[model samples]
Target chain A: MSSIDIAYIESDANPKVKRWKRLALEPRAVKRERATLLEGLHLLSVVLEHPKAEIAALILSEEAVSEAHELVEKLAERTGARVYGLTKRLYDQISPVENGAGCMCEMAIPAAAAPEDWREADVLYLDGVQDAGNVGTLIRTAVAAGFATIAANVGTASIWSPKVLRAGMGAHLAAHFVENLSPETFREHYRGRIYAADARGGRDLFAAPDYADGPCAWVMGAEGPGVSEAAIAVCDARYYIPIESSVESLNVGAAAAVCLFDARRRRLLKHG
Target chain B: MSSIDIAYIESDANPKVKRWKRLALEPRAVKRERATLLEGLHLLSVVLEHPKAEIAALILSEEAVSEAHELVEKLAERTGARVYGLTKRLYDQISPVENGAGCMCEMAIPAAAAPEDWREADVLYLDGVQDAGNVGTLIRTAVAAGFATIAANVGTASIWSPKVLRAGMGAHLAAHFVENLSPETFREHYRGRIYAADARGGRDLFAAPDYADGPCAWVMGAEGPGVSEAAIAVCDARYYIPIESSVESLNVGAAAAVCLFDARRRRLLKHG
Candidate 1:
């Protein structure tokens, strides 16, 4: 193991502190640097488990180091990552959660493959779903349902944003993510049957027996506008989750959970 | 219709403003007054549609009045609700959403039915589900799935709170809500097959063909602790949603969606 020499940062104005704050708050900075910030111990632990995860820096508050000295030390030893300690006040400035775990990691963003290079995978395509929490919950739901990949179009929330990351609850580590793709590019490059989720004018999802035992993609639209005309045109079929007419529609996140898990249920019944 | 005399309040210290603020922010005030605040145009429209809805006061920003004069006038005419206008600054203080709809309503909290008084109804029992957003989402999901009643234990978030009201997206209008009931009382009074949602040690929900075509209750627990032992003990059975082993579990709201919709799907199939 490399010699343990931890740098201590005391000021919010420090360059490292500035960079961390930018990464936590600004999506552009994350994209520009090709790095994302993982906050709290749960996310850090998940990132560590991934074989491709590359830790650029490991930052801990003084309190975090005091509270979890052994775990922090072991992580640093295992990854040989450069470690930095921040004063409590400085740490609070960069922490996104109200009661943060006081540990954060700056890690390289995972590379995305071109549509042409996409492998046979169960993919979730998010089109214009802008709510960060919804996006994150969908990602978590996707992972739980055994989806292998997530591809989000331009209007969707950045998958690496801090809000989405927190909502994802470490599910990002288990799935491949591709972002900022256009509908045209996605259709041209992806080699899968695409099913669009629509509220009206679609077959009942529960009764639809056409979900083949092969690679497929489920395209979800934005909260209100739903999938664009262009995106809808490329889909192989449209499916709707039945609901009571008294309510207008289900929340996108809830809708995603029902659909994704239903697909999983079908697969298990067919394969098992 | 009574002559429209919209009283305008400019000062934050005004009694009406103080009361609205209290109703919006303080749970104790809401419970004491047996009233809750509804914000925005969509909620107001939904509340207006309920024949039993009693609007004690209607508060709108001057901008809202100007922007939606016809709708506001119609609501006042229909409900005969006393209308008050607030300065933009005063309205912003009480508005929960970032883009305040500039309208608010103070309405009676719907009376809850005793467990014995509940008719043949599909019920959702929430035990210690404290997150406001989660509580609201579950209520919406329940309504969409044709559940007729919601019973939340003491530790659950207040069903009438502003945050929950907003997240519910008008589902509250269609469902009877009971709160502060203990597991013992709930079991003694409720008449339905009780199924607890468990992450482990339960029949596969998708494969469980035993869901009788009758009134049933799905008991969901808090985000972290899952269902309490007391709650679980009273349940007739436990059902689990099958998911991948890589992730820990689905979010409570998401889990509710999958389970509730599955029940609905089954009912539709049986009846269709």
Candidate 2:
């Protein structure tokens, strides 16, 4: 590793500390700067490994440098990004998690792909799934299920938000994220069978004939209102998970996993 | 309906307010009191509908009473439980959610079922799935998948904690809960085949044959140190949810959903 020239900041009012705090706390600030805060060793490693990830800066608390010296050095060397050390108090203020690893970085937001970019991808479209945890879990599930791309409509939670990133558990680095698209734009540009997951009044998910003939998009709706009527109208099919009648529905994240994995199961069956 | 006798308390120091706050905020307090605080209209309604639910008190914020007068009237009449009104300040202190529905109830924690109580029930054993959200989501998913009983082994999050209840949505009312069991105790009591969900090195879940012939128990492990070795040793079979090679595994809750729902589908197919 190259000699580390780490600048130390003890004041909370430092401009760099203020910027990092804003990026962690304020979605508007993240958007304005076109950068998001990546926290902890796991997420930072993901960013480092991602071919498209652009690192702006790395910030470490005094405690973090002492605890993870080798990791900090390697990360600093790999990105050739300026490294700053914060007083523990300032680090605590900027850390999104309680007793965080005290290491964080500013990284350029992964550019959202246009509809044309996903033409050959098996896409997962999130329609207003407002819970950040659900959104992140879906991103992770989508990658595990082998979906190549993810699109989030306008009403969906910001995919780059800190809470969503934490819930996503570094899945963001592995999948293509196309954010802030309207349902209409998604309908217009995507050339694939669109399957909307419904709680009721649809063909059974398992009973539906094989869908492995081509790439498809699974449109998951929000918790309560479900897929918006406008989004539903554009779907080629509606699939219902066969849940017992006593309950209203599965949590959106759980529902997404069932659907994505089931599709994968069908694909495996067809090709094997 | 009987005349609504709603009592009002302005002071946060009031005993009733203190008790309610304790129940909402502290799991130990909830256990000692043998009750839990239920928030929002939907969960309150579930408690009201449950045949065995015993209401100790129904607390409504001024905002909630005005916004949901009909619901308040119906609940007040149905339970004959004393209704208390809190000043917005005191209400905010006790409310578990952001923008809470303003109504809550203290309902008796249903007695934990003994091993004998689960004789013919399809059981879901949560083995150290410590995240409260995951625990609650698993409970809701288990119910929707028609699992009649849930057993949380020691190290699992409390099933009736506020976060779990919120995530559960109202699954707590519909399913039987068995808490604080050892892995050996669970094995000794459950009279069915036990299946542990593993990330790898197990039979494909979809290919598992004909479990609908009898009751079965699904053991879901924690997010990190998945199904404890002790717990796995007690299982009759281990099942793996197939996923893309690049990713590690599904979230515990999502994995539980896929497993429980797949069992439900098999049951339906068998009955048909």
Candidate 3:
């Protein structure tokens, strides 16, 4: 598979192509069996930015090789991974999305280092945020805000799913993720100023306890199911992002961005 | 179709149903539809709060109807929408998402008013963003920030798509939207102000023009392909949301939320 020769695939019937395309079928496909497909130059590069990101293969359309000539070289040269060029028809079959960005990278969500680095960090624990897009966007916000790690529980979508890998737009590289979390496990490993965001919470997130209150860890629940009783129970305090009377709640991803970034503001203020 | 006698679906395989279910296939499908396919009482009720939200129809699993006897009648009476009782086979077919939440509603994205309303009002124009969920969330933010209307140009997804409808939640009731815009049309009828959000803009979105500069517009382009040349050219000013070092851009929706609400903070000062 490591041969640099372009393995052109024109038919949608290609076995690997069909399997790659099927990755888009669910937010976090339990396709635990298949190699996760990564798309777009931005995300693939993001994964490569992280040392732990594993590269199984580089699956790209032949046209992508010709068009993004420079990117193709950098990707192949850096990773030492297999580069297989498929036909456009097969690429579509391998594409998780419709706008087909012309490339896909097969990678593994390689095991993350234990929460050791996170011992002195602020974390985001996601409980069953099943939407892959939301999970991905939150990861982007988390990375941009400088969160070191994010843990997603069993019910939440895997951070490595094709859609999330795409949505994170390579933010996945900026952060580390561990999946298959249970509330107890999250509370057990994460020692920090834990705050749960709920619309009905007593305090506002903006004026939340300073990050100096300890190694802050904010837990957000899924969109509809919000933080579970387990999550709510484990939290040190509950904080809410106040909204104008115009809406009931901000979308979960948007809410997380607002809260997570606000948490970062504390560090920025103290330092700068 | 209006006969309320029996619970029925016109076909074993209907295109719209397939489309609805197709959304469940992709992680972003529901978000892309601009309509979240909400199941159960919680979200359906959350959305039903905003005025003018249309519940296209309702589907109840036969088992669910039996267990929650009052649900069917309650939903039908409250929403003036159709109710269908379905066996597991049909119910499973009708349910596009994994968390079928027992009951579901096909929420509608209300149509926008004519361009006349946007001609001289504070409008938020989406120049090129193609993400349905991003478009929807921005609309929600625009509505919250007190923008009177939203105008989405070509290259943006239809606001009425199910995903936007759901993302905007009930923002359709708060603001208005008009699709397929042209720069000439905007220049001719729009006289107040236009601010294009870009990395290299003329002004800080945090410190925008005064409220006396009422009825302005903020035009946002697709993430990668920022505001169109014509759209950017027409703007009276360009506003940048300052970011920390190492960051390239803020998610369009997040930027909109911050900027629009900052402008909205004016209403308080003006009318205070």
Candidate 4:
């Protein structure tokens, strides 16, 4: 506690405060800084334990400084990051969620280089998925199901966006993510089976024979149009989750969970 | 179009406007009136197709009436539901979303009676899942996986709340829901096997032998504390999704999807 230095910020106009507000609200700021804001102590604690984490600052609401004083001191000491205590109003301005845990941090987004050959990578590919919650949930689900890499096309939402990060529930700290990818690039580099999540026509996912336990990519698309034409052009086949014929389709997040965990289940049954 | 009468309501203080506003914002009003509001044309279209649907009114923004006039007229005629054209400002007041389709309706809550015996039922029991989105996604996933019944414990978020309804994406119209059930009642009435979604420890879900294709229930709980004690008391077994050991847990919605869909997969494999 004695070693932790806490800077108290009273004004929204302070340079640090303004920059943080921008980082929280504006994607451009996050890109320029190569960092993003992670709200809540839960995310902060997860990031601190990641081997590659580089935390720039920890911001705590004035109330949190008192309510979570011991834990805050421990986190500050562990990361040796600068700590700022903000007025509740100022903190609220930087947090997108209403009535959130009054703690957040700015963490340097780890630069994960894509493998020169994606032929042997088990990947989750996002094609034009723009919902932050969906993208975040997919990341979390992919990690849970043992996907090591995630590649998103240019039009997908930023994986590090605040809302996505919140939805990710700390799984962001575990996976290697590559964004701004193109379908042409995916087709050229990935020499493995690629299965698009097709809603309209495909082999029934549960009844289909399992793909060999090797490198594969599960391509998921936006909710409306589903897997894009470009993405479909690269797929070895398309698979559709079986649902009630009257229901429209499974939500993308739910579909991903069903697909990925089924993949895991297959792997477990075969090996164990 | 000639068969439909579109009433224009401009005043926010009109008694009709006030009552509809209360219905949209207050759960008490919804329960009292025995109806809930469904926003967007997609939901309206689905409810119109259901045989039991009784729409009280269809409210549309001025913009939507023009943008979707033909479809609106077709829907109104199909259901013979009263239509009201609201100013964008007033329409936005009733719709919880931003930049929505601007079509909404108050539909009567369909009456569904509990089955005489749960021994032959496949159900999804939500045990104190307080997040509206999680509850909704669970409903959608369960319905997709062919679950016919949903029962939630008393402390779970209201299954029919606007947020939950919006998240359900029309699944609410497809399934029978029984909310505010006590675990004791569930234990007494339901003589089937119940599996709780446990994050901590349980049979590795994928490796566990399948339950026979008969009456069964999957119990899903809140994210933080997992399943409630009461819900656990009624569960014959606990199942946990396998994930990366470093990761904490899967989101409740994702967990439910994995569990329910796996159940579907087992059934498909057995029958096909």
Candidate number of the best DockQ: 1
Task: Please give, for residues B1-272, the per-residue lDDT of candidate 3 as tens digits.
Answer: 12343355555575656765765445356445555355555446555565366666777765564423355455666777777655656667646344444676676545556767777788898897888779889887777556758887777876665456557776655677777777668777887888888876666544444732567888888887788898987888887765543345667876676566556545654564
- Which model, 2 or 4, shows the larger TM-score? 4
Tell me how many residue pairs clash in candidate 2.
0
Better of 1 and 4 by DockQ: 1
The residue-by-residue lDDT of candidate 2 on B1-272, one tens digit each, is: 32578899999788988898898888889878888888888887776677578888888887775545456667778878888988778888888887777888888888888767895689999998888889989999999989969998879988888889999999888899988888898888778889999995788886666655689999999987899999999999999988776567788988988888888777777786
Q: What is the TM-score of each candidate against the true structure?
A: 0.96, 0.95, 0.74, 0.96
lDDT of 1 by residue, B1-272 (tens): 23577988999789988988898898778888899988887788787678788888888777774434555676788888888988888888888886665788888998887666563678899999999999989999999998869998998988999999999988998889888988888888777788999997689998887585788989999876899999999999999888888787889999999989889888887887
Error of 1 at B106 (Å): 0.9
Q: Can you write out model 3's per-residue Cα lDDT over A1-272, one digit (the tens) per residue?
A: 23255556666677766666666565445246535777776666555566566677777775564434455556777877766777776676667666555666777666654767675677888888888778877777766666658887788877777777777777666676677767787777776767787876658555444644457877888876688888888888887765667666777776776666666545655564
The CA-based lDDT of model 1 is what? 0.84
Isolated chain B TM-score per model: 0.95, 0.95, 0.78, 0.94
True contacts kept of each: 0.77, 0.76, 0.15, 0.73
RMSD of each: 2.3, 2.1, 6.3, 1.8
Q: For residues A1-272, write the lDDT of model 4, one tens digit per residue.
A: 44568899999789999999888888778877888989887787787677478888888887674535655677777778888999999999999787876888888888854666355778899999999999998999998888868999989998888888999989998888888888888778887788998998988888888784787899999988999999999899899998886578888999999888888888888988
Mark the regions of model 3 whose C-alpha exceeds 4 Å error after superposition: A1-35, A45-54, A62-65, A68-70, A86-94, A98-102, A108-110, A181-192, A206-215, A265-271, B1-122, B144-148, B180-193, B200-216, B242-248, B261-272
Q: How big is the positional error of residue A83 in model 2, measured in Å on the Cα after superposition?
A: 1.4
- Let me know the TM-score candidate 3 reaches against the reference structure: 0.74
Clashing pairs in 1: none
Query: Which stretches of candidate 2 lie above 4 Å from their native place?
Result: A1-3, A65-67, B1-3, B65-67, B207-213
lDDT of 2 by residue, A104-191 (tens): 8878887777767896689899998988889999999999889969998888888888878888888888889888877788888888
